[model samples]
Target chain A: MSRPLVLVVDDDILLVAMARSHLSAAGYSVADAQLGAEALDRLDERTPDAILLDIDLPDACGIDLLQRFKRRPELESVPVLMLTGKDDRESIVRAFEAGAIDYIRKPYIHYEMLARVGSQLRIGALMHELSERNGAMTRELDVAARVQRSFLPRVAEVAGATVAQRYRPTTALGGDMCGHFIAADGRLALFVLDIAGHGSGAAIVAVAASGVLQRAINERGLDAATLRGELSAFVDIERTGFYATLVVCMLDTRSGELQLLNWGHPPPLLLERGRTRWLSASGSPLGVGIGPACELQTLALGEGDRLLLYSDGVCDVARDGFELRAQALELALRDEPTPAAVAEAALAAAASETIEDDDMSLLVLQREAV
Target chain B: MATQVIGIEQGRLDTSSGDTLERRVADALAAGASEVAVSCGTLALVDSSGLGSLVRSLKRCRAQGVSFKLLDVTKPLLRLLEMTRLASAFEMEHSSRSGAKTSV
Candidate 1:
């Protein structure tokens, strides 16, 4: 509890003194600067809770000073109440245009001055408190994003294929998650999960699910069906109400035979030699207890083939329909045959003036077609 | 002024409408509607928020011991639900069997 501080910037000695005495008597700590340069120096030393700026200063135009003050990102929101002489309509209008939040005409009435100062102080305090809270929240989310990132595997060679992934969340933390597990028997198990909701809860679940499967898949090769079933059994939808559209596949790189199961996700696309094939949605998403009866399907991902797994965010790109999206995807793959290139092509179509519509994630596995 | 309740007509669900959609279904249940069915025939799109509303609606119905289901779900809406594996979350009267269409 110290009193709110006010910085008074004016060239008039008597007027500045009056303001300082009145504001101090009204429970405010006051500081005054006669020149605009002095006022700016005071500001650089430390930002006060509020500023009362005179519309005219001997050294510089207060309007110019106000513009400069507003330009600083840190002080953009601080309340600046312009002090204008009565009948100076142009100065009052110009002060506001330069970012003064409010103004009081001079021949400064003690009561009016105190009232304007008090109200501005309240708003300034509230804004400061809000920004502090937002800063703390952002820091916490950054840590959560880091933790979620750590659960994902490092980009490396799985069996004989080069594996790489790219994911972007709409927010600080997102629900879309992907992970790769290389089993003891050299089967590379890869999964891409998109949770139903966005933000912290979905992100937490995505990371947790990734961790669970990584441990389980690395222990003993869990077939695709059992992997989905075990994941479903592991969750209590009634309690957490969290479910994810995921596709998990085990690739035996040597033979290029991939055992795949997709629960409700966009099918993983398979690009081999000169042809392209879209993977179908073979089952239901996890956590709904839908008894999603899906049999494991085996597809050949021979040498020189690339398989791409992506979230539904990519599906939202095509304007006409799914057929258009498929055609675009196939062309991109045939042209470059790299996971990043095709994923980029899909995203460019989805790109709006705002730069994004939803979170997009891509995991690419390419078998060296020796 | 009479309160307006949104029925299952032609509203394509999105994040912006999720809360109102939740309240509308809750009100219908509160007013002693035995069974609530929403028609999704004209819905061209359903985003994550729209799906979120359906999940909440299902929860509210179970809590109030009333029945609620979706009707005439469009192919796009059904495809969205299927991809999310939410096809079994509701019982469809005109089950377009809208799901089960896979790629590749």
Candidate 2:
């Protein structure tokens, strides 16, 4: 291992030499700087593990310089040991407040200097290790977040109809997921689900659930009851005690027919001529005992008609009240905006409300003019 | 058999609270209460984790053959429960209802 580097800043040449000899003998690399400017220049060249800064310097006040060093992002964590006169009690206190880790009085004993330096070096090393470990954990979380994003569907167009979707998680990973695929019979199958919690555990369940639903939809093509059954079997609901609200839709593109099954999620909106109508749910959330028969509701979509699906997070917060938030959303859609514009406006409105943060996902589909 | 009324004071029951509600219910059962009623009069929000805790507690009550119910359910919570089809699964009384029995 490389010897821990120590930067010693003092106006006294003899004291600098003495500290250097003792620290070098005790397995430390010593760098000397007489002025605060010299010390900053040395920092620019290389970062030291610990700094031995004198309270009195030629060019700058040592405490002020210490504060400057602490302000720098790269040198903030480096241990700073202040060198003070034995009677300078106020400077000692000021040095500490200015971010000095430890201090040694002037006319110091060689052994005492060595001991303080050694102890601080060990602490600095431990802090460095902890910082590195946290960095590694954050990198791993970012990778998991990327993997989660990969599963999100990029359904810009489905069967000649325009589609736009957005997902915003309260954390690096969230439980909200949406996907779409066109069937051989010209029907577009799309889905949006929100697992009960947020974070890695919920995200893991979300990924598993997404895979299961994706497979079932591709194979069977929009069987709400069978899809629910498959999810009940696949998810270890008993072990995890987790559940999710989902909406599955199959739209016959040629005939403008839309089939929707909402399971315990927020009601989807049917937007027509700048007005909004809620398509409310009748079924229970999944993994909650499969209690009731989930009913599939069929509707007819006219030209220029749009469907908006969103997670509960978008609508949970209240304005004057929760009901007002829905009305605010309706007012935003009054201009008959595109899917993306509608999403942007809804998110802006949601941002203005104060409430607990949850994963928000919005998917909008609009039929083209005939 | 005595009824134990446990009130939820917090506005939200979510991942941050972990399994506090479940633990409270477990404590009620351990204390030999034959019935448990959570007074959600102050509760305004519940996420998936909170819902999970409720379900787990309900299942625990069922396993021990104890009666469990939620009292003073808020409109927002009721909407969530109804949408999730949990309203039927849980025996709940609306907040406006009167004359329900309570024991300390």
lDDT of 2 by residue, A237-325 (tens): 46666788899898887788899988878888887765679887878778876457678899988777888888877887211367877
Candidate 1 CAPRI level: acceptable
Off by over 4 Å in 2: A37-41, A71-73, A109-115, A234-236, A272-274, A317-320, A354-356, B94-104
Native contacts conserved, per model: 0.32, 0.43
What tens digits encode model 1's per-residue C-alpha lDDT throughout A9-62? 999999999999999989888888999999889888877778899888999888
Which ten residues in a row are the worst by lDDT in model 1 chain A? Answer: A349-358
Q: Write down the lDDT of every candidate, Cα atoms only.
A: 0.74, 0.80
Task: Give the Å shift of residue A75 in candidate 2.
Answer: 2.3
Highest TM-score scorer: 2
Question: Chain A structural similarity (TM-score) per candidate?
Answer: 0.87, 0.89
For model 1, how big is the iRMS in angstroms?
3.7
